[model samples]
Target: MKIAVPVVDDSLRMAGNAGHTPYFAIFNLNGGMFKTFALEGLRANPKVVVGEDHHDHDEHHTCDHDEGDVEHIKAHDTMAGTIEDCDYLVVKMACKNTAKSMSNVGVKLQKYNGIETSASKVLSELASQFK
Candidate 1:
């Protein structure tokens, strides 16, 4: 089975929030061995600037939904693609929208207290559950 964990860094030492993680650590479980890879693209916190107001002119600049909305969609798409090949996803926290998306794609979501735990430790605990 394959498990994907959202990691805070490339070292995979910390678990990150599902929707906002910058990288995903994918671990493939084969017999007693494990192989892992890192996926990068998504941003944990994307800055969305609405607009800038100019005092000289009575004009307000604002971003159209076309730009912001498209980026949002693309981010989710990238995230989905990152974990598509995995059988399971482990996250410290996930929003309802993210959970719904995972469910739609048939990927099982596992919740864990990952704040104080490392990715390897969490994976080990999950493996023990199957045994």
Candidate 2:
């Protein structure tokens, strides 16, 4: 089994929110032994932003979606694709859209409710559960 957790920096701290985190620490489990698999960067899926007058914007921005935004859907689709090989995603917090997108791709979302924890620690706890 593979578990993906959004991370903040090289220290491998668990990111508070998955939507904006740029890195993911992947853990691989085999026979109840878990090991670090990889540290992956987020794959970019750029959106062409056109202004009201039909001019493209130079800066990047996350579009505010109201349940049916195509751009929003595409963004989450890309996010989900980043960890598509993983069986589960462990996050401290994730927005509704992110959770929905992950679920759509068959990735289970696991929430950690305690204080800030490192990705390694989170994987340690998860390994205990599978034992």
Candidate 3:
């Protein structure tokens, strides 16, 4: 499983969407252990490749179509694809459209109320749900 946590420039979870979502802290989890080694603070790279193959296989999938209709097509596609691959998300707030789009891709949205949540606090809060 994987988790996608957005953050501000400060590395805290991101709060909202804007003209663009600049970056994401993607956690690559194996067995839900939440290992420190799995946390990756990914910066928004415009040309990032995100296809089913990029997530696993090595082939670069192709879309046989034009990209001009979508203004920020690359960025939007990457972000949405990344979110889709994630099983969990730590988000502050987002437009309903973004939320719905994410849901369409099976991303589980975990809305955080504030921006200053500590790592330990996050663990504690999540643990409570299981208890």
Candidate 4:
């Protein structure tokens, strides 16, 4: 199994928001062993400009199609694509819509408390869960 985690940098520090992270640390589980690899972050198509990076923007919308809305959806979709090969996505927090959209694409969402700061530690904990 493979787990995708949003990271702040090459060090693999967990990023609070998946869409805004600079990289994603993908952990591969084989024979109960895990290996870490990184992928460049996902960005929204340049055609859409989002003024602010808001994690809750999807929660406050009211049937309106604003520029940010388009960008938000596109960004999340791109994020989903980045980890589409993985079996799970682990994040500290993600907007409700983003999580739902990810679930639709067959990537299960695993929300971890911020207490664990490193991707390696988080992957260890997740590994224990599966065992």
Deviation in Å, model 1, residue 113 alpha carbon? 2.3
Q: Candidate 1: global Cα-lDDT?
A: 0.58
Error of 4 at 56 (Å): 13
Query: What is the lDDT for 22 in model 2?
Result: 58
Residue 111 C-alpha lDDT in model 4:
72
Q: Candidate 1, residues 64-126: lDDT per residue as tens digits?
A: 234346666565555666677677888767655557567767678887764455777787766
Instruction: Quote the positional error of residue 126 for candidate 2 in Å.
Output: 2.6
- Candidate with maximal TM-score: 2
Model 3 TM-score, 2 decimals: 0.54
lDDT of 3 by residue, 11-89 (tens): 5444254213455666665433443326655655243442323221112222333446364454445566756777766
What's model 3's lDDT at 104? 70
RMSD of 3: 10.8
Q: Which ten residues in a row have the lowest lDDT in candidate 2?
A: 50-59
- Model 2, range 82-106, lDDT digits (tens) per residue? 7888788887777778788899988
Scanning candidate 1 in windows of ten residues, the lowest lDDT window is 54-63
Model 4, range 51-120, lDDT digits (tens) per residue?
A: 5453422223332344468766776677677677778888776666557568868888887764887887
Q: Candidate 2 local accuracy as lDDT?
A: 0.66
TM-scores, one per candidate: 0.63, 0.72, 0.54, 0.68
Superposed on all Cα atoms, model 1 deviates from the true structure by an RMSD in Å of: 10.1
Instruction: Rate residue 54 of model 4 by lDDT.
Output: 33
